[model samples]
Target chain A: MKIKSLTMILLAGTLAACSGTEEKPVDQNTPLPEVETVEDEAITAIPDDVDDGNAIDGGSDDLSFLEILDDPTSPLSNTTVYFGFDQHDVSGEYAPTLDAHAAFLMEHADLQVVLEGYADERGTPEYNLALGEKRAIAVRDYLQVLGVSANQIEMVSYGEENPVAEGHNEAAWAQNRRVKLAYSGR
Target chain B: MIRVNVFFILVVLCGFNAAVVKADLTFVVTDYVEDAIPIAVVPFQWKGKGQLPGDMAKVIDSDLSRSGQFKSMSRNKMSSKPHSPSDVQFAQWKRQGMDYLVIGSITPKEASRYSIRFYLYDVIKKTQVAAYTLPIHRRVFRKAAHRISDIIYQKITGEKGAFDTRIAYVTVEKRKKRRLYRLKIADSDGHNPKTMITKSNSILSPAWSPKGDKIAYVSFETRRPRIYIQEVATGKRTRLPSFKGINSAPSWSPDGRKLAVVLSYGKNPDIYIYDLRSRKFKRITRHYGIDTEPTWTPDGKSIVFTSDRGGSPQIYEVAATGGRAKRVSFEGSYNARPRVSPDSRKIVMVHRDRGSKKFQISVLDRETRSTLVLTSGALDESPSFSPNGRMIIYSTAGTRSRNILAAVSIDGLVHQRLAVQRGSVREPAWSPFSRR
Candidate 1:
């Protein structure tokens, strides 16, 4: 049975590889994932932190000075991004925060992080679980666009189980539906 | 019309009577009983030693009352309490307008055992209907009472009873900024709740094995969701294959040899059949949308699940052997968590009521293709069918606590609730009749 399943996995991998020749040929052991579109423009700072962005980017781009992560004033300090009701799209407003975090992650390539997704207590837990994953994936897509490697992010969704605010009102729900960036060992 | 209230002096016993070690859950009930088969349950004559461990009559009476089928005559209304049919005055009960009469006596045996004998009588005909004497240990005094309730229910309704079955649920509480999740199992009446797993992580979607000896659930103790199967008797756990992304919603197949689990493989979630003996997972559906909450039809031919392939979440059916996925629900924009009845005629699910915009429990008739909402809660989810498929138990927004477990008859006539003292409970899974 083990051999049969292994053979089936190999066949699936081979079929996926053959169906998408445009996909990277380097990895034939897995299926081709949806390619993320990386924006060509450099990262932008939130309007309120234009002066701070300049001072942080003044050095060589290759340098991995991650001091901005500890700086309370840096936009990178805001590790969480909130979502609207039943929405997974990373809003245009959160782009600056995502970009700053992505730039920091791109410089610190040796470090890895986990994007933890969550949802409010409105919907069924299983459906909310998938919604949470979609929320995390949206953040992951934005980070990839800012040049963060996909391998550096691991997504874990808590669904509606882990709630920051326990109230049953919309104020609590809005705070519950979110994704937070946390450092990972890998 | 005058409303009647029933009071039961509940007894809390320790240790499990059957497969568990210990037990915690508190329950109070609110029911609507109108024109139910009026019956009288005379307190069983327990004249033995130090306070009988538990009241057999209270347990039996409570079961009948909550079922919304029989309204036990209030104790204060009964002018005479009899211990047997020979001692019963049928004219007196008939005068009180009770259709049926119940009388019993208990004899305590040495070493914490009881010889319980009970009877049901037709007051109008003055004929003895049914009698049973159950020799039981004090540990199983309540279980024995439930056993009597099951027999009485089956005899009067000519159908199977689910009073002796069990339900598994998940509880979550936030303490000191940390979350604690626990999976618990208890009697059908929400008594003797035994903790199966307790940790400072997230646990959800607990499903009982067909034999009622094991369970499958998703736990996040490792900081990621992974499916695990645990033995109810020994509390042994075995983790299934965890992929890169999500590994949640593990459901046991009816025959108990395979599991219908949801796996994302680091991308889109899909349903898969995992064979326990072979330890192999065969992916069934391929879609970009989230396909989860899989439940197998009792016939084991098809799997009904919730999917968002059509923009909004809806129920879909896919052949177990791998085929095209067909949408099966059209009543509303959101219908999920489908649990097929044991008889294969109806399906209970969590549906968003189009008018109220609240998630409620609804039943769909397979032959008619129509849906009927059964609950009126702001948020109701995780509906599981009783072994007989006559009732559905789910967790919903609670008036007793923040969240509580509730049950309703398939006909939507009766309602019952089980609440804990602290935290909240969700994801209730009812066990099949323990064939043993």
Candidate 2:
């Protein structure tokens, strides 16, 4: 099963890379495939509930947020949330994962997470830094609205530096324009 | 590939052997003027020397050719090497299609000084235009060549030459999983390069003071961006206030008393004046949007900066003391990293063309209200004007996926690329004219 999943991921990567270079004309009739694929991946990755055998159910909370977030097989394992070019608004697609994080933070008073926002290497350095900060702050605000404490979140913006992918193309840029949720205490 | 790598390593190692290692950047003219006047710079005759103090003639030749105003004849193409006008056959030069001729001779004097004599002749008019004899120290021999070029350039073009200047640039090298960033300063002709500061983290936005004695740059050595001023001669650095959020985009005021920096300790990234004398921070812009890359006007009365309050990044101007900001660039949807010209009439930035994906350098004329694209690149940034306001040096992606430095004439007539053998060069700041 693992080998099969790896093969599928490699296939998807190849097709996406080729399509990115060819830049096939999009038809108004057909839906955007990449966005749909991204949404499907995000949806299938997360679990409906955080209930697990390791959860300390004797307490008021029935499930452990940190355990679910740390579990590789869980949907909450995906720590990075991507954004559009020059955009700071969080899309509704990340709602489930953000909800899981908010619940976890609220349950554990000592838990803290750092939202490191980054922008693609497109605009000026200083302005991109501002945009990055805004993206992290936007994520922080959403988490706060979902019941996460303000003190639990710390924001930092790397701007266009420290890109995960190095190419000057859209695929690389998409991977770079993101905010990574780095949780403390392992 | 193996052979090329070996050769590159050897070149870099040789450059690293000197006491003060120099990484010279040679220029390849990518564009030129159509009606460039032809000129010949004869190799200077060196007496009682194993080698001349420096290649004075070659320096002058490169400077003139890089300007796009003149085409220098190669030494191999010249029929004779003349040290003075007495040995010059004007008719021979005219036959070779050269309009002007320059000849010089170098002689060592007492106490490590050199006496130099040079003459510029107008071949078309068949008369000597100017001649000079000066004694200079051995350490300043390269500068002497630039001075000669300056004299010739001013006589011919009736404009001050910017040959005798320095350029401060940033270089980044990826070493395995780590990146090394170095702030390098070099002669304007791309010689005698010395690394001013090297850090394990990132460094950006180097701004040379008006006096050229200090440089202000942003360093992420502490894991957060902080502005620091480093004296050029002594290599002394003083860290400014870090504040809460971002501290970046440091631009020195005209008189060097203040630095316009973008700090986000407040609600948003806004321009703030950090007075050097009093060491106080005075807010300049109060907008909630991002205001960055502030450059002072020549007269020091106003500052032009990049702001996104208009929905997209655009150049805007505000009073130095503080007032309502006015938009300066209207045509482009993405214009940022503004650098005002020495004349205070034009501003340049990394402009993203409307409806296009590529980023390029562009200039805006305040008086004419017209913008001209000066470069064609996938990414061109940090457009800084020369001290004379004639040429602009910027950073662009060159071959091999490396960011190399480039210079373009204000009219976009002449273009030269300054490509290093390794790493990436960026954030070039041309120094003001030296007092000497």
Q: Clash pairs of candidate 1? A: none
Runs in model 2 deviating more than 4 A are A1-67, A73-75, B1-24
Highest DockQ: which candidate? 1
Residue B156 C-alpha lDDT in model 2? 87
Candidate 2 lDDT, tens digit per residue, A1-186?
Answer: 435434443443343344332223335465323311111221121111211101111222333546677788866788888999988889999998888778877877656687888999887777787888888888998998988866567667788878899887899999999999987544
CAPRI class of candidate 2? incorrect
lDDT (Cα, 0-100) at B119 in candidate 2: 96
lDDT of 2 by residue, B344-380 (tens): 8888889987898889999999889699998889788
Clashes of 2: 2
Residue-wise lDDT of candidate 1 within B1-436, one digit each (tens)?
2234444223333322343333355444455556678888888998597565666777788788778778778788989999966788889999999998888899988988889999988889888889988888977777888888888888788889888889999888769887788999988877777889998988889999989999999887866677889999999998875555578888888899999888765566778888888676776776777899999999999999999988888999988866778988998868999999999999899888566568899999987989988888878989999999988999998763378888888887667767565788888899999774
Off by over 4 Å in 1: A1-67, A70-73, A184-186, B1-23, B47-51, B109-112, B399-401
Candidate 1 residue-wise lDDT, A1-186, digit = tens: 435434443443343344331312224355533323212121111122111111111222343355556678899878899998778888899878888888888877645577888999987888788888988989998998878977567677888877888787788999999998876321
Q: Provide the global lDDT of candidate 2 against the true structure.
A: 0.79
Which residue pairs collide in model 2, if any?
A45-A75, A46-A75
Task: Give the Cα lDDT of each candidate.
Answer: 0.78, 0.79
Instruction: Supply the TM-score of chain A against the true chain A for every candidate structure.
Output: 0.64, 0.63
